[model samples]
Target: MTTPSTAGSLRSRAAESPVDCDVVVAGAGPAGLMLAGELRAGGASVIVLERLTEINPLLKAGTLNRPNIEAFYRRGLLPVLRQAQQETEWTVSYISSRRSDGTSTLPRFSGHFAAIMLSEELLDESDPDLAGLNPPDMVDLVHQKQVEAILADRAAGLGAEVRRGVEVTGFEQDAEGVTVTTGKGPIRCGWLVGCDGGRSTVRKLAGFDFPGTAPEITGYHGVADITGVQDLGVGWHATDTGVYLNDPPRGRITTVAFDGAPAGHDTPATAEDLQAAIRHVTGADATVTGITSLTRFTDNTRQATTYRQGRVLLAGDAAHVHPPFGGQGLNLSVGDAMNLGWKLAATVRGTAPDGLLDTYTAERHPLGAWVLNWTRAQIAVMRPEPHARALREVVADLARTVDGATYFAKKISGISQRYDLSGDNPLVGASAPDYELADGSRLADHMHDGRALLLDPTGARHDLVAPYRDRMRTITTAPLTDDAPAAMFIRPDGYVAWAGEPGRDSLDEALRTWLGAPVAYPSQTPDVVAAQR
Candidate 1:
């Protein structure tokens, strides 16, 4: 609802009013913390309010997909992420369980869809989706708790104030700013972002429209001390009743039953409940001796009609919710944060182009919708009925092939996601490939500062971009590949905004489109020499 007039008025009012921070973020989950760091990197002050006093230790995503990994890598978080991965007992045990020769009894996993496993070995190397991925593109097995910890530390290190045990109860937004009501007190900010989970209070108080389908399946995921189920081998198993996954090293198990959604979504499922669900799915007399932690989930697909309304915005699960079939939730949420953080920061700093903030929804809503349908399709493939079994067989066969596995891998890992940006270059809207520059540093190496970059191999386009040097960085680096563009503009979030071949390159429109009109120098000539000064 932030029309041009309202937006202009809001900016005017925001400047007149004093605020606690540039942005106030609800929820300290991975999405919120990631966004806090991103905002700080863009030189925006941030305050993160969390309802929980301590980090939730419940088992969640055990892997970071390609896009998720890349997001951290661009922020220079990969090393600490790897260190945290090594510290996790589950990761250590899982790694040690494999054969000392670095092989496992199970096949090498690329990813899965509806519990249908895909082997990394069967992936098509020639697949465009797999091309140009640097070493960091490989999926990393890091616990969600570790991810939260890493991001929380990073955000705090970057000067974002993260207040725990503070919950956002209500909020009011206007042209000027937002007043957020919380348990501790009230806070005023230029912008408000709800990285809160699916049931977001900010979205509700702000009256954002969220519409989507209902849940038909109840899923249980947890870690427990289980016994009397040695026959229930590790990995996904599809039985007549439902599907169950047993991973002994991780002491984690998941059961998907089409027995309607759980009545209580917030309460943790009991050990007996998990035992019963496991028995129902696996047809084994599994006994849950004790539960370390447990949670209930469902395939309830929902999405906010729009991610923004005036100064209040939504991201992560606040914007969309779907089944966790492919472990896509964490990746999807992080992607939302990565997309919104820089744009919101730019708006706070008064450097964003007109409609640039709105593009957050325009670019990410389709991906949210795509993920909703993606999880729904998995539900269809996972139905316990006979017809679904037939479909599963066909899907399983397809998944075992190189092309099919690669296709699913591309989607599940989120490498195929591209913003519908306008440009003739094929790579324009996609995540920029980690191109090796002439100096040997990868493209990701220069993105730690979270500024837009113009990679000019010819070094001839500096004059065109010098005026916007504060908002964008110009790098004189040649690509190692012949097919690479003559010059490329990469957004802060690592997406290719524009690219052109030799002699065909033009950056004026792209720069203006993304970075807003250049800061007017004292000189206005096309060849303003002071631009470099």
Candidate 2:
């Protein structure tokens, strides 16, 4: 990474803040950083504004799901992810503990591919693009702090300006662009993105209303760095006391909801409470550790009414929050960042119509609602009651089967969740389609750019996609046999928005809906090129 630079120069107005940019992200967290990386990769000039002086690399978010690993790879986060593995101590065994002698057990895990049960269908059916990037050797564990540093560094390296210790106070947008007021000063930009924490300052300042279903929830948490907790294994523990353990590499982040206060209230936590809970559940004199941080909170199970509001868009915690049932928050936030980044870039660069920005909400809002629903379902099913525990145990038994394991792993990883977008044919907005290459290579190889790919089935699929080649990253794969159909249309968000025997009307509509069907490619014809020359 380049040497750290101050937010702006005090000597000159132009030097201190950018007069204009393709995108301006508020809050340089993972969502902001990942989005900045994506925009920069797509050739957009981006500015990322972070409020905190130093990275709050601690407190939460330890597990990286299979889909998240795939997203990290898409946003140029593979290297950091690789580095993150070095700091991890892999657990040979993990058990999702419960009361009355029942637990969800996974024997082995290393990287992207877990022994967990959620991915059997994809693997057994030989899904080509199911992201075979992780193995037991690399990804089951890592430090949250390290990940923050890496993503922040990658964002900076990719040409996005990231400024920490700079708070975004407010913003105003005109027909052309937006002007953001910050602690450093006022900076102008083409667009704004709010990736701030749950109580996002950007969302609040934008005057957008947040509406969603209330969580049937209450919760408390403690972040402790107790030693010897290692090799105790990884994963979560739902106890009869209405608490759960988030045992990550750094420490255990225990959260439980007992008394229903506000949806989110941070009450102080103490040693006595934890020790009592531990003894009550494990039947042992528990070893204690230093209290890094403690909080009491209630699950909101709420999502923002909309993702984009005029010039400012909310992402990550700013957009949604719920029980950490599936470890969905981080992955979903990453998805939010990836979805909005390219749209803002395209609009700023004038490749897409202004309406392109509207798709962000249309595509992601429903997905956010889905995650909230799943969390609520998990909360209800995980009440620490004998019946709930027994049901979970039954599910675990099913997980022992190959079919069951893959489903559980993939679902919990959030990789299985894809948005239902209109205009997408069978394969348009679907997960990366894994097809064979004539050269005997994997289909995922061609998806390196993180853009939508038009896969040619008859190899003739290329002829259809060639005209808009520059607008979309079209690729050629093996011929479609009876096992697979004709061609498949893949969308950038890794979902099959549309697919099937390629037809003119649906393809036209799908293209138009997603990419504004990029009116033209290269923005220059041979005649125009000659004229310019």
Candidate 3:
């Protein structure tokens, strides 16, 4: 908990510290801040409580997937994610594969969906550090602090109160609302959102159970602004010793294997140890300018069985913790907020029932599990044993030759992973591409505001959406004219809410699931008006 006046914002002093809001977000990290943004976008009254004196300088989650980018665009978040960049250059560092025998260098791939989706070209590993992602949104070069501050500003702009240095000590909640006890003291609110970190005080006070296995093996990772050391590709550089680098061309970020590190302890990781490991992996002593940030974490893959308990609920790390192998923590946190904020806002705004909040945990908990399972498999394949290497080789060869790199690529990039329930089509619950509309327009252009968008066929009835204009944005079907194109059925989070041919029945069904009811587009042509009548 920090004092209000000094948490790097004099702007707070100009305005009164809010005692309460509809939603109170603890922890000013990306997760907390992004949740705040989503709540604000949905017109929810929000208050963000951060104990930090300032924002974090480290760039934590290094990448965001295509699905995430699409989500951002649909939700009107790409502007914030990209800021000023026109295009972003994603880095494709080194890759490694190990089985029972020995470790060998595997081919590198870009986290940028364009390279993976359009070209299959692996860029230099250091691309994202200097440039941004494709379209400059998902893979922008904003530090954790910068992104946090950006969201904080957005929250404030959207009428949400953001209080820094106000440490949230605890909370008391009932059927109605919540009263939060902060370092700044007690404040009352209609709802409290615990966006606090893995060791959340809010979760503890609420007695929310974080049910999952804590990894016996831990991993240590550090980021240093170093000079020298070229591309290692993007993947693990496994020794019988155990190491996996989020490797970049300029300076790869390497981590000790889960088995390599001591169990249960998150401490004892230092610059000296990281540099030594770097030396071993690169086979050279590179220039170590300084450590931007360092963290030693036990891989704990856990999620609260329920995200909400009464008026108080949890989001981000407060609700779940898993290995960072997928770079999903930040995205997952945003997803949590994206899932919950709108639903919570609708409830608060008197449009939806409180029961909708339960779906937040339902949708996201399993997504985290998939990431957990995949990372575990990746860790197993990287194990430094002859037996493990042999087992991995047989599968890896089969996957590549048979299943192909595209499948492997999708898995690693999170493109292949779909949700538990995708409405009717498999593509519905999956990520939507930055596709072209039927009219040769970009899907993003139609998502001017944060609303569910339906990509209707050129002649399909747009009148169906016109009725729910406030809740839905409708676009005409168009073929891909350029590299970037419009897509069909965009959830607020930018996932393909629905796919295939868009019709009256299909569009209405999608609206019901995503927006809670039937929606109508604003543009009502004379023909559409006649048809409705």
Measured by TM-score, the strongest candidate is 1
What local lDDT does model 3 show for residue 99? 27
lDDT of 1 at 306: 96
| Maximum-lDDT candidate | 1
lDDT of 3 at 44: 71
Can you tell me which runs of candidate 3 are displaced by over 4 Å?
Answer: 1-19, 77-108, 111-146, 225-235, 244-249, 257-269, 275-290, 395-402, 420-427, 432-435, 438-440, 456-467, 476-490, 496-533
Summed over model 3, clashes come to 37
Q: Of 1 and 3, which scores higher on TM-score?
A: 1
- For candidate 2, the lDDT comes to 0.62
Of 2 and 3, which scores higher on lDDT? 2
Please write out the lDDT profile of model 3 over residues 99-135, one tens digit for every residue. 2332225533433210112113322324322122234
lDDT of 2 by residue, 97-215 (tens): 22233222444432221112233333343544334434222443544556677778877888889888888888887645579898778888767888887888888888767876565
Please tell me which model should have the higher TM-score, number 1 or number 2: 1
